[model samples]
Target: MEKCSGTTKATSKKRNASSTEASLPDCKKLKSKDGGKTSSNKVQNKEKTKMEKVSSKKKHKFLGSTEVSQSSKHASKKKIQDGWLEVTKNDKGQLLFKDFPQFQPNMSPKEVLQAGSFGGTYFRPIYSSVTKQHCEDEWKELPEDWLKGLNVPTQVASSTYRDRVNTYKVKCGGSLEMWESSGWIVTQDPYGWFQWYCRFYQGRRTKDDERQIGRWAKCAGVKGRWRNNLITKVVRSGCGFDNPTVSPVVRQTLQHWGYRLTKEDYKEGAKRVKPK
Candidate 1:
């Protein structure tokens, strides 16, 4: 079951298939104290790098299979053009961010969504102050099949984090209150990090790109603190890469960040982490 504080508290209870829509809190309700440049504390820690020590580890299956879509025509039309980079407004007509990344992200937004990250709650539409619906049209640009089976216009509170939708069937996250208090919430990406990531992946460059990418790097990059722990503690425990039981929480969290943890990732991390 998913466990988070604040608006998510009511959602902690396990939901049945026949369950009716429950009351949800306002998505805008939140808190904070100190302000900072980075999105979350995940970037503040001195994490770690790709594996450098362990060797000959086995492959792990952390992601579900994504079969080719029958609606090939729609998928083909969404092709992004080369040498074309201009971020306009989102579906809501809000002026999008204007900036560029020094580098590209390692993964794609659709891949993360299909792989089952954020408990299928990441893209759930929260109330949009502008058009009363945020970025709903953007989903149209994606493969119609990829957006299947998600809770659209998700109840702002309790229903936002459905554990069953997650690949690991476990819940791991802080509440909107926790994120707001940490100064992680940005108005541009009202739903938070993944929303920003989705736009970024679509080439919606923004000033926030550098900071967001920095946070991602600190979370999964070579020097990522989370990656370090995964290599030193979880992987070293002999649970192997495929063992979700090894660090289910961390694994799920990484999935949200566009990183599908694989045995190869474990191998590279092991190479970087092995002792002298």
Candidate 2:
């Protein structure tokens, strides 16, 4: 009976050891599964973070391009505004010089006639008369001797004559005989002369007058070369004569004068004498 009891106790201890071994294997398998799941989650989280960073960088790049485009547009607008302002300022400032004493009105028909004479060589009278009419009030009258000193002919009868006497005759209702007797040639048609007259007096006269004269000058010689030469002479002389505002006759006269005349010499004349 004692042997049997000892054997039974040994069998029970073996069974208990077997049960512990089985439970230890189950615990180790559960731990391994949990570790694997955690590692997979960590990898997913890392990938998600990298994708988010890439998306954020792309957004920043796109936004930077938009900002740069807007800035460039704003700068361009600013430059245009500045240029406009400069033009406005220059125009406004020119008004102050309107009252300058050197300003003169367009010359009269009688002055135009005298300017064509052999003894009356200075063509300013003829040019001023035909081109500028509005500024008459501002001009200081000149003396008679001013022309004599310049060595200009009192009567110009050749093709090179600066005065468009024949033109004036046709437009002003003078007889053709009068033009012939005056030694004037009919180079420009009446319409051409009228256009020239209108342009020669543009800014100094009314816009209506300017248009009228421009049409006439166009009739006489609408070519660009003639127009450009007229403009060049006016600019170089600094004669205060706006080339765009005068008749062809006046333009021709100014061109001739520019070839021989100097601004300094004219200024001296202005100082010494007043326009009659």
Candidate 3:
């Protein structure tokens, strides 16, 4: 009976050990499965974050492209109109020509006049012309030695003489103030009169005249005559007063020269010109 009881105790211990060993594998498997699930979740979150960043970058690029397109369109429209020139003064109170693509910095007033001449414009002297009578008397009386010292041509010297005599007869005083206020003084044309004829009358005729005709002319023949007269006036006006085109190259050059055309200006120009 004692041996039988000991055998029964041993059997019970073996069964309990076997049950614990089987349950240990299940506990380990549960731990491994929980770790795998945690790792998978982390990978998925990282992928989602990457996708969001990519999407944000694409949105920004699209917005940038859109803004550039709109700006270019505005510039194109503004560049086609007359009287769109923007003039401003510099720190020295000297007129720094704005909206003039042909003008550049460091150019002397004379040089500017010379260059602008090609566009049917020339710079006129601030002073008024002397009369022929005064030029003969006052200029001829100057001492021969003094005239030689002046080193100017006889014709110019004579003109100066006449100018002094007629100065009183001139309506406006020869001064910068008068020139600015009246807008009468101008520069010489560089390309000569024939070039002016081609540009103002020949080239700009149909397009510009058609538009002007709509506004000013009452009939076809009248409009044609008016257009011809208008071209003649433009050719005579010369540079600084001439209507000029603003090209893309000119716009970039102006920007490089520290002139920033604002978006608002572009928009306003676009509204005014309505370029095709």
Q: Locate the minimum summed-lDDT window of 10 residues in model 2.
A: 85-94
Per-candidate RMSD vs. true structure?
27.4, 33.2, 29.3
**For this target, which candidate reaches the highest TM-score against the unseen true structure?**
1
lDDT (Cα, tens digit) per residue for candidate 3, span 117-159:
1111111122423211111122222224323433233222222
Tens-place lDDT per residue, model 2, 1-276, is 899999999999999987887767443434445545455456668999999897666544542331212234344233222222111112212111132222222332233434433122222222122222211111112224322333333232221333334322211223333533454322221212322232222212222333333333342222223444444445555555443343444444433221112343334333433223
> Worst lDDT window (10 residues) for model 3?
117-126
The regions of model 2 sitting more than 4 angstroms off are 1-148, 151-208, 212-276
Report lDDT (Cα) of residue 210, candidate 2.
35
User: Model 1, residue 7: what's the lDDT?
Assistant: 40
- Global lDDT for candidate 3? 0.31
Note the Cα lDDT for every prediction shown. 0.54, 0.34, 0.31
lDDT string for model 1 (178-215, tens) is 77668777655656787667555554445676778788
TM per prediction: 0.54, 0.18, 0.14
Q: What TM value does model 3 have? A: 0.14
How many clashes in each structure?
18, 42, 13
Off by over 4 Å in 1: 1-106, 125-145, 149-160, 272-276
